[model samples]
Target: MHTRFTRALVAVICCIVLVASCARLEVFATSTSNTKYSNLDSSKWNLVWSDEFSEDSVDTNKWSFTIGGGGFGNNEQQYYTDSTENAYIENGCLVLNAIQESNGEENYTSAKLSSTSSWTYGRYEFRAKLPGGTGLWPAIWMLPKDINVYGGEWPICGEIDIMEYMGSDRDTVLGTLHYGNPWVYNTGYYDINGSFEDDFHDFVLEWLPGEFRWYVDGNLYQIQQDWYSADSSGTYSYPAPFDQEFYLMLNLAVGGFFPGDPNPADWTSTKFYIDYVRVYEYGGDLTPDSGSSSTQTPNVNLLQNSDFTTDYAGWTTWSENGAVFSVADSTLKADIYTTLPNTWSTQFYQNVDVYSSTTYRVSFRAKSSVSRPITIGVEGVNNAALFNSTFTATPEWQMYTYDFSPSVSCSGAKLLFFLGNVDGSQNVEHTVYFDAYKLVYLDRKREYIFR
Candidate 1:
């Protein structure tokens, strides 16, 4: 018994020693990691590009100002110009200042500048702190180079706003991606909860094949994919406007569509400071992969199951006969399908927990036995419309996807894939086959653009 007591004491001592060693190692590792990339160590990042702002004044060689803007598209009240007084680098940071000095007839003056060169298929990032005022609107966004001459405009060329903030609320930043069938017609915004004035946060935009992601301070906030498709009206078709190259822009405007006019009685000096801008390219082909769900049902299978007789190969729908999964065409394939409307009532439908503020992409194979265009709507609990799209498939198979930016919160929204419009009316239903139905989330973290 004495020997057993000694052995127990030794074992307890050994465990304590092991725990202490682990704690020490963990502290050492963490300190080493933090010291290695102490924010200023741009060496960890391959300084592909930057505007150190070393010159005594703003360098015209690197940037040119956009002059004489009526409303810079935000119904903003400021007139933008290329003047040095409006923008320059002081203390080693580029400053886009918005002042209340009288300029022409306008009550406020600000600066808007852009890189003369255009970049495509690269990661773009900038570290900056925002200015404050009730009507101060500052943005670090990108516009496609072809927008000026090409047929595409706003959403068509695709607008990627890495970071945008209003002076009234200096604590929040907005990251957005604009694209789809109609150029500049659709817009998506994600509000990241953080303070912009407290410290500099890195804003990143990753542009790649078929997808774009926005990040703030290395945390992924939003993503957009499957950008363009054709509907019966053909109004939404904007030939992959974002697939091309775009240029970077920095502007601090006082009042417009978003911020309106500055309050003359309480006008203050608002400045947007940018420490650095970096752009990075994938070392190799890095395509976005499908997402996995950790918050949804544990036993839920993320795969699509269906049966259909139609040629639509890349859809997830069920037919009346033996359920068969199909994916003949490269672009079009079918995984699963069911004829049952209100699929939540059946066991075939999968339950997915989603936030109204979240964004997702759902794809599936779809083909109709009839030649008519079929309308499909996604409904969850409370029968809310998550997404809706209309498509006409040929005799061959074709895959279709409807992206969602939930307008409201949905926790137990079972994925309902069915025919007809959002109102469940105007049913031109005639046995549409669906296969390979899938729901994917786009989780992204912001990275330095020129990294």
Candidate 2:
């Protein structure tokens, strides 16, 4: 709909005057974060909305372009435009490409698209492959559907970063939330096994009452609950900023606060290919009892010798790759120096008896010398992890738990804690502490539901 005069005027505007910068990831390390959790099943949830991106053009009904050229809040260098050169559909995918040219203003050109619709709570999924190059920042994130709904700006309205990647770091992806006080929030890390740019992967965000979870290809990397928002009078609540509807946005920016600067040599017309996007409504069978405000007692503890006050009497340890295991009075020391190029190096386990067709919760206390990731799971007869996730270990002892339903009861079922996988640091040497393990049955009628 742009006329000849409008197009010519754009062509004669101006020139690039400055380079942009990105926010440093280091700033988030000091944020007020939350613990990890693993208890979601996409197969059990119902789809509420989806876009396969099978059409040959940008669907106007589903998405609208965020067109501009000024530093997009992050001092970014790209001028986002509506041109097909920057965005289009190809081979059943929505492609958002960042070019090393200008729109008579910024030094770079790219495309940004925002969903026309928004929702309150659902599992948001984006399956996409990224382009490679230093300083390339591709993000799939969300903002409050109505920023003024809370009567203020940004942090008060809340922000959710589903997946954020920097070309400078090819193997890591970050998921973060911004609410309450600025830059104070929760985040998760994704250490990919292969080049993320080489294949398509699913980046997901699960938002529910009092919780937020992030995952990459079904591997839950993070979950958060300790976030808040303040009102105009500075009064805050538990889930204010994030309890409202939010809309989604996708874009590839060049040179920003987090990714630093871009390398012009690596600019080869790469595209951010999105395979599809989906949002699901809650349809799980299990939920918490909502009959009364009074407290219901927790399920009785089913674990024995759980405190390790005696020793590793009911437990077993396995060291893989090049690692050594040692047990002192109360701690299990797994000194892992090396690992198989693509495998785990150490594991600590205990077998427990269980009743058939029952739901149980496993809880534990743990701490590690250095901040590292660990996987905990419950296995059946063949040691197949029926439930699992990666949680970070700090120097301080933290308590964690997960709930799962067993298909068949077994006497020799194993409960395991594993660390030092090939997907983690190649040269890992640390000790993790464990104590006070507990297991109990969760009421089948009691589930976590949004109020």
Candidate 3:
């Protein structure tokens, strides 16, 4: 009886070990198999715009600064100014300072910045680092420029609040859209929150066909659509007035609606810093494949495309100035002989599943023409997160691979190719050949375990 029991125990332990090993292997396979993608061409959009704060100072051509004391529609108690002392760029960021003192009519002086250019339907994002202190109100918002001329009202023109931080609550940021409505003070407010004053965060607004979505660091926080009703005579009208484009505004208002006036006894300077702002639009011609209904799975094959071969089967060639794309001995080459300082090297275009971030592998074939060092990198549309490599290409064609695993920390990432001075420096110029470019699936389990 004892011998039989021992044999049974041994069998059970062996089965458990086998199951654990299989589970680990499956995770590795999943991690390895997933592929991520993004569109390489940005020209399809009517406008791909951003405010990177690259200017030595704020550009008055693009943004206007509001001045003086007015009702400001919120009973706030700060004087806005366009003066260089109140607002400027330092250390690669826009600074909107709130300083307490007798300046003009108010006890505090700050900056109220706005964009004269407006858009109707698009995606908007701002990368910002905020300030925290008592009696400070910083906001990135939009309002219809011709509201009084066309609709004769505030909410009628529509308002989109991308991000706001009130003095009382430094940790929270809010996003709400105000439209022509009756139940809630001519507008309704929806908000999402994040810990401001700590690190940089991305505030996003996606305005699609009939609905709008708001996100803080790619997390959906609010949605507004034409589902509610409001009447014409300042009453309830279902499906409100959101069909128009709105102008963009940024300001640091002191006190009033939420953050209410600075305390004179414990006064210090507060700063609102913005890193970058970007906007993207739908071309309407490119239709995304939403996946198979029967299979209930995304088509992974659609996410993979590369143009490193001589034939250029999967890519559209983009050559400007002296840039050239041709093949030499089974290697795809981009030749550049530009005397023009502003000329861009050859770029390739591909459509990708940009909305999701799964594991991915992007590899390319390369060989050097000269003995100098070169750089290869990837950049997204209206983005600054660049993944780069500094390698001395050999005479023989060799493969180089890069894997992308996005954690929750990254804002947005995409695939791009470059072969020259990526930082826009005047010195870097090179000729190189590429071939056998491949984007493959990742085995996630093994990926994570190895990591």
Candidate 4:
């Protein structure tokens, strides 16, 4: 009987030791194995792109500003600008502000930004809080990377609206796709517990070859697979637009063809905050891990302070021979008070991100006191010149455009605006003004201009 009692005692001690070892082993666990795949299926998914909006200002490298209030073919009333007052980064989120103000042509001003990157099939996710007010419409959507990726015009190419919220119906969030030969639209919406302005929520799109699923938080809200495109020639089969690559877009529109005007009392200033945008591709290291439930994302812009609205924030200046650089009236101005012609002594420059073997388009507005010439180009910050051109700036403000494609890839490329002509020897004193400098990655094939 004593021997039996001793055996039982020994077993108890063994079990205690085993429990202690397991507690210690937990310290060695890998973070990768513990990643949460949200509540949805993330099998074989790999994270491809993300923008956390951690910077105090928006990064211009991965995004391009889409400026204009041209109704966006929808009769939207808001005039979109690159101004930070209309769009900015605040408290770790992108704030797209829509306010009532007439720039003469439009009664409202808002901001729209588009991603420079495009993808085919992936899981696109975002965390956001909407701006609420009657007649306001905010959208997170995509258009075909190639305006004519399929044969024919838009809708044929396709459109994917991941999420859209209308101020008229502050509690509903919508998902939709526009396709077909004659341009038929399919859409669905889910009601939220409360106004999106009251809290942040997850908006996601799981896009596959033929099937597209829309979800709010973790609940599936919509699914669309059957779509068609009718063209002058013929109607394509299902998935014509769904099959091609598409680039993402974010905009807060006011008074469009869909939503009507707002009551002045209800049309106060409000902001749509986007916390992050994440893109995950299938067949990555992550498998449908049933353990995690969080998501974050990123998108970038190559140039900082391209608008010169932040007091020369993203620019480096240099001058000599009485040349001076300053910001006035929200424009970059260089006054070469003393005569020193053909010298690059006075310059304003910024280094931007670019990829090799890729083409980019640069456009800006500049003017001079006289018909003076200026040199603008893109080169490796400390390396070879990829693009350079000399143009004569007229007295009136004019838009100048040039296309650049680097043979070699680079991340920190220099965008130089030589205030004084580089090759001229005339010592004529003059002033030059610049504003609205925009650089964007171009898909040459789809440079068909627009969808």
- Candidate with the greatest TM-score versus the true structure: 2
Cα-based TM-score, every candidate: 0.55, 0.59, 0.50, 0.54
Instruction: List where candidate 1 sits over 4 angstroms from the true fold.
Output: 1-47, 148-150, 181-194, 229-239, 264-269, 287-451
Off by more than 4 A, model 4: 1-43, 284-451
Which residue ranges in model 3 land beyond 4 Å of their true spot?
1-47, 148-150, 181-195, 226-240, 264-269, 285-451
Q: Model 4, poorest ten-residue lDDT window? A: 22-31
lDDT of 2: 0.67
Q: What digit string (tens of lDDT, one per residue) describes model 4 on residues 15-55?
A: 33222221110011111212223334466668899899998
Predicted model with the maximum lDDT: 4
- Answer with 1 or 2, whichever has the higher TM-score: 2
Q: Mind giving the per-residue lDDT tens digits that candidate 2 earns over 191-225?
A: 87777798899888888776677878887665555
lDDT string for model 3 (214-323, tens) is: 67776655444322323355433323445466677878877653555566454333778888877788775432223322221222333333443335433434443446
What is the TM-score ranking, best to worst?
2, 1, 4, 3
Local accuracy of candidate 1 as per-residue lDDT tens digits, 1-451: 0001113343343243323221110000011111111232223334456777777887777788877644543445676766777888878788888876766666677898889877777778788878767878888877777764334344434566766776776676665565533322212333446546666778887666655566667765444443453333443333355667778888887774345457655534477888877777655535333332434332233333333234432122332222233334332232223333432211123334456555566666656555435555555432447766666755566877666776765433446443423233323334445565566554433221210
